[model samples]
Target: MKIQLLPSTFDENGTASRRQHLSCFVVDDRVAIDAGSLAMATTTAQKKQIRDVVLTHAHLDHIAGLPLFIDDLFAGLDAPVRVYCSAEVLETLERDIFNWEIYPRFSELKNKNGASVMQYQPFEAGREFTVKHLRIKSISVNHKVPTVGFIVSDAKTTIALTGDTAEMSDFWQTVNAETNLSALLIECAFPNELEELAENSHHLTPRNLQKELAKFNRKECAIYVVNIKPMYRDEVVKQIEELQIENLQILEVGQVYEW
Candidate 1:
């Protein structure tokens, strides 16, 4: 598996930075974990190769760039883009995003191949599904909105990506149970001072993240921190460093990891 976080922010030099804004993690260039920064992070050819995308929730930061991505490829689709999500998320997307009021209902539209430009592949929580060579399962997580974290494996290596979530149990259990786990991508969005806000929004502060890690029994897998709100970036990173968690890393935008 190969994962890369796309460009979504700017640095002090006015050059594109990976510190803020929306993002998408592409695996093997064929499956995108989310489409948040798909269009901006990848090239036209890269976008065209994405045949499967599994969403964590209907939140804009996670699915914001999906509509435009589909639209851009509308005229040249070789096959329909299959979007995987929970039924709740699918409903929210259909009602709020692809409802025509916000964006065209690409799922209902077709390409020159006479096939739908996009399609929904709704999967229930806990049920495992396949996207090419990967085996994936979604675990419900404590987010303000309906959300899920994904556990992906390719037999030899397994990894988890917990999209915006607070201190939770089931997700940890799922992670610990994975024998071949190699990496974990989780969110730590606020600083210690903003614990209340983090909890209310179902996000994790570095303090909360410290407590969350206590639930895990294994330290073999690399834990990568993600989804840090731009305003709190420096503070969060400092706090995480203070925790001294072993094998922990901060995921960088445009950075790729192969396993």
Candidate 2:
């Protein structure tokens, strides 16, 4: 499996920065785990190939680019863009985002060919579903709003990703049970100094993240940190580096990793 955390922020020189303001992971350039930077950052090839978007939640940063993504290819779509998400997420999207007042109800619209422009594939938490060639399992996680983390596996590689969340038990339990796990992508959204804010927002700080990582049984599995707030990213990275845990690293923005 190939995974690339698409870049959402850029520097003054027009180069992509390491700071991640949104969350989107392109897997094998075919399926997107989130549509955060989908409309803005995808390559021409990616834009043409990715028709399946699997969402973790309805957070703005996670779904910001979704509407635009559909609009970009609205006229040419022969098949509907399949969006895999939980029912709660679908409700939030319909009420807040796709409510015509905010954006066109693409799910209700059709292309020139009479094909639906977008479609929702809602799945309950704990149920395993298939997106293209990948099998995905969603586990409910502790977030301020309805959210989930996913365990995605193809025929060869199996990986787990914790979409923005605080400390949680079921996610860890499910991850630990995956015998062929290749990598674990977890989130640390705040610096250790802002532990209180992190807790209140249902996000993880480096300190709490360390405690959470203790629950994982696979010592050899590669661990990558993601979703640090753009402003506090450096501090969070420093704190995580201080832990000096072997096999732990930050998932670099815009870089693809094949496992």
Best by lDDT: 2
Please provide, for model 1 over 83-130, each residue's C-alpha lDDT reduced to its tens digit, 9 standing for 90 to 100.
999999999999999999999989889877887889999999989999
- What are the per-model C-alpha RMSD values against the true structure? 1.4, 0.7
Q: Considering summed lDDT, which 10 consecutive residues are worst modelled in model 1?
A: 14-23
Q: On a 0 to 1 TM-score scale, where does candidate 1 land against the true structure? A: 0.96
Question: In model 1, which residue pairs have backbone atoms overlapping below 3 Å?
Answer: none
lDDT, each prediction: 0.87, 0.95
Clashes of each: 0, 0
Q: In candidate 2, what are the lDDT values of residues 156-255, reduced to their tens digit?
A: 9999999999999999999999999999999999998888999899999988988999999999999999999999988999999999888999999999
Instruction: Please give the distance, in angstroms, between residue 156's alpha carbon in candidate 1 and its true position after superposition.
Output: 2.1
- C-alpha positional error of residue 231 in candidate 2 after TM-score superposition, expressed in Å: 0.3
